[model samples]
Target: MASLLSLSTVVSHRILSLHPPPLNRSLLFVKPKLPFSRTVSRDLRMRLHSQTTNYGDKEHKPSSIDSKLNPLEGAGTKNLEKVVATILILAQVWSPLPLFGLDSAYISPAEAVLYSPDTKVPRSGELALRRAIPANPNMKTIQACHSTRLFTFWIPQRKPYGTMESNVKKALKVAIDDKDSILASIPADLRDKGSELYASLVDGKGGLQALIESIRYQDPDKVSIRLASSLDTVAEMELLQASGLSFLLPQQYLNYPRLAGRGTVEITIEKADGSTFQAESGGDQRKSATIQVVIDGYSAPLTAGNFAKLVTSGAYDGAKLNTVNQAVITEDGSGKVESVSVPLEVMPSGQFEPLYRTPLSVQDGELPVLPLSVYGAVAMAHSENSEEYSSPYQFFFYLYDKRNSGLGGLSFDEGQFSVFGYTTAGRDILGQIKTGDIIKSAKLIEGQDRLILPAQNNSSST
Candidate 1:
């Protein structure tokens, strides 16, 4: 039988002979010492001169033979042959016929150095190696290595659990079996890293210890905790703003003319609750009351105009203060009106200019603006709608105190209702009156059509 090297050379020669030679070449020659050299030369010469030769023409046959024997012919064929020859030479140098114990189960020194991970050993060699080693002593060495190192290796020929997936599963099982030991074995410097990996494994298995272990990853300096706290605060503020609670940020105060030239009436709220507590005439007694507000446009034109339009022909009269919580700006019309209410005429909040001339500032103490300032100011109420411009008729008062300089000095027009007349006096009186207080008769004061109060007793008291 031909040696493996010779057989390889014969195969190489057959592949080279299929291609044609380039122009201006007569013959091809390859060095003999090289494994594929002689066969390559023969093949290349055959391809180069075959085109010029005719078997029936004896004269041309000699030229063909002479061309095939020469080394300078068939440039293209020669170059191709040289490439094949080089590959064959490399194959011979890299893989030689085995001498003794050639089919060892362990990787050969040469192969270990030169072989890529993708290279596969022949099955025949694997069988030979298995037969040579009785009872496979190498298995003990493999098991020992597996015990010491975190990794495991397997020969491809070994049946049953030789696949990558199987090996990985095995490793995982081993790791989990000795989880605590593995964690303890890790160096101190790498404990955190090891802990994270361990936690991940434990998490998959549903363990409280794993969850608790994750906390160790948090910064011990409290920086991460502070950052988380800040984020929570910001998220809460964003939620408030989204919920229409941001309008309470501005001060809310309502100023309207007292009935019949009695001077302007001012009501202030210091909380989000629509109800405000009043101190008794000369005592510390407190009471809560709801104020009915009308927007007239006679005294404070801007304030009255803005307030009147919101109430009557405009859009604010009956709008709801959709964002009132207890004790904060009970009601206020300072924010975008359309957002809170819908009116006969759609009016924009921008139309209501601030009337800063009156004694409306908190500095004046007429209306104290406070943190929960939605208590008792006039505002349009509306139903919740996707478009935000659907509030009408549902109005509340902001009891919270706020600056009202911008809304205090506004004048009212003839046809509008008083924009923000105070109901505190009425509320106070009503509060003091028991639920059974009977009204004998009601009448307007002599000539003042706007002055209306509880009728005084003309009868003598016993």
Candidate 2:
């Protein structure tokens, strides 16, 4: 026991002497491996024996040896205590700094959103649809830089400012400052109208200038109302400048019916009860009313083309309307007239062409060019036998209600169907139509020249 005690005293002294005070604590605590420990113990035993032998030779007495070892043990204990106290002081000083000084390390909401991988997630149906449209390279660049387009698209998705006035003023300033770029977006024939709208936006009586005036008055409600009016004008200017159907259809799918540009479809509705239809906008009541849907072929050429062709063929002349939850569906028209099924078509955002026979995964952040979340969205129904194709004769007008939508204001069926068009005019009439209402007539009012039939391509080639 005396030898063991003395050996520990000698080892501690050697550790303190070889490694300075600062490193002694670390060297002492590090658990040596089995072989290293055995070697170290053997070397320490030899050194201890040599020192003990020298002391014995000089003193020639056990009492002298005990006196010397006792002092060495005391010194080793004092050095260990000092090392432990230094470690404890460091722990106490640095631990509190993390709890007190790291508040600034947390990221802000804007920073979090900016760095998010899913930043392309759209907040509005219109914005989603617009982003999905595959256009000419020049047109896409112009659309991205257009002030009115940015203002209209950004307002719905931007982070909230303290006041709506700030949001409106910021968006308006962006739009007003880019007048030259905005004018360039307009078609050559529409530049005169575009210039007039620009003039109206800057200084007209009820334009965005009026919004600025309302903001100056410090009336939030007036600012809100005028902001809506100004945005409406901005939206009109954007529509006038949009380039339609600028990309070419894939060569393999060229044989299928395709509308190369935009088309206008007008449907006349009549009540089943033979009652006069309620007129919108204070117009006189009539037995029949007309609603116009502007069908886009750019994003959904095959689906929109099929729909336009059916309208031109008088397939829906006497079809019955059936009302389902949040939708107004047309009869299948299978027994009355033959219909050709088209592959399911959806153009994903940032993609060049529509993916045929595929449905977008909305949960995975895939959004369609024509979102079905709009109140008057028009989409083809799924084929009776297969979900991979659309029921050529049956279509529906979606009655989108935000109360029924999921996150980002998208409908439950946002990217599932082939949304060919929207009920641009007479959207109010959609809600009034009953289950037994008749589609008295459906006509393609415009864009026949833009229809590229399979035979027309063959004839041109020959």
Candidate 3:
């Protein structure tokens, strides 16, 4: 076996920096000694996460989006809309291009109606949708920002979830309104190459994994694909910029596994009384709401499977809105997180979580059953002994409403909690969720028969 000293050196090198040398080159010097070398893959998946107290935006000089990304450099294409559509589709499964995270799930009705794209944004304060556009018109950010609106032209009209389609249209319209940033944070080279790569997702070319590979392919530093998932600090961002990193690390706030989904599931949440009431100051009118989930059997199968089974079996029925953590802006905080005697529907989720979770520095690479950033996103609770994803029962509703999160929408529980569903219909009902309220029932009304439920753990639920 290679000396412990050798392994320590490699760990040290990667921990300090988000980017690591290519795998083959990294292991080149380590002579094989024993089967123990297999441990290298497991150990190397450990990612170093970084956070900033400076929730402030950087002072960026206004420049052409094309100048910064330069996507059109080698592309001989003359059509602007097609070029933009291709790049807009190459998304980080978890990468929040500023808009993807704050869709209807995150937006409020009043704000959604009154909100307009803001051209003037603070230079050094935490960046906002308003500031995503640059002061200069010809800047790359401006073009790339507004370019997302044209995606409707390229994206197949059919989407798995109607809500996703609606959210995409709403987000794009807003992005176009302010010359906003879509998948604009990536480099021009990747953006330029993304159209072809993005199209490959449908033609059986590749899915999220392909886009991730493409991002690494554009890296001049030869950063490892797995390491590419780490969160880059400002200092690390500067380091990547200095080393010519592929994507703008600072702006990649929402980072998770980059995988697509098979289809959608509509989870109908029936109020205890099956009745509605008006609020004192005019609130949600929808008595019952459907928590729509894109049964992402592709990304986190175990998590998704467990959730599907529970919904189909009516396991979550009568689950009360036990707890509420205001700081996280979540409803129904799982009350009394019981021990994980819950059958374990084992999956490769944690094993490959580094490829998904961002802003989270844990070694486990498992992705949540669903993204927690969206509103009405239903997620399982966290446990003390097991990993953040050992969810069997219990869930919550995330409520983040805004075009721009500003300082109000920081979710500390994103990678830590498992979100398996999204709110589609009756979003207004979310306002009525309160402590002591009961989840009369949770039924998979749309895709009940289609869901892949997790098998009961025969031998300890493996």
Candidate that scores best on TM-score = 2
Maximum-lDDT candidate:
2
- Give the range of the ten consecutive residues with the poorest summed lDDT in model 3: 46-55
Worst 10 residues of 2 by lDDT: 44-53
Candidate 3 runs further than 4 Å off: 1-147, 150-291, 326-359, 362-371, 401-409, 448-450, 453-462
Q: lDDT values of the candidates?
A: 0.27, 0.60, 0.34
State TM-scores per candidate: 0.18, 0.59, 0.37
lDDT of 2 by residue, 1-53 (tens): 23434544443333222212221121221121100011132121101000001
**Per-residue lDDT tens digits of candidate 1, residues 301-358?**
2232333333322333222222211111112323434322221111111122222312
Q: How large an RMSD does model 1 have? A: 41.1
Residue 50, candidate 2: Cα error in Å is 99
Show the colliding residue pairs in model 2.
none
RMSD of every candidate to native, in Å, equals: 41.1, 26.1, 23.3
Winner by TM-score between candidate 3 and candidate 2: 2
lDDT, model 3: 0.34
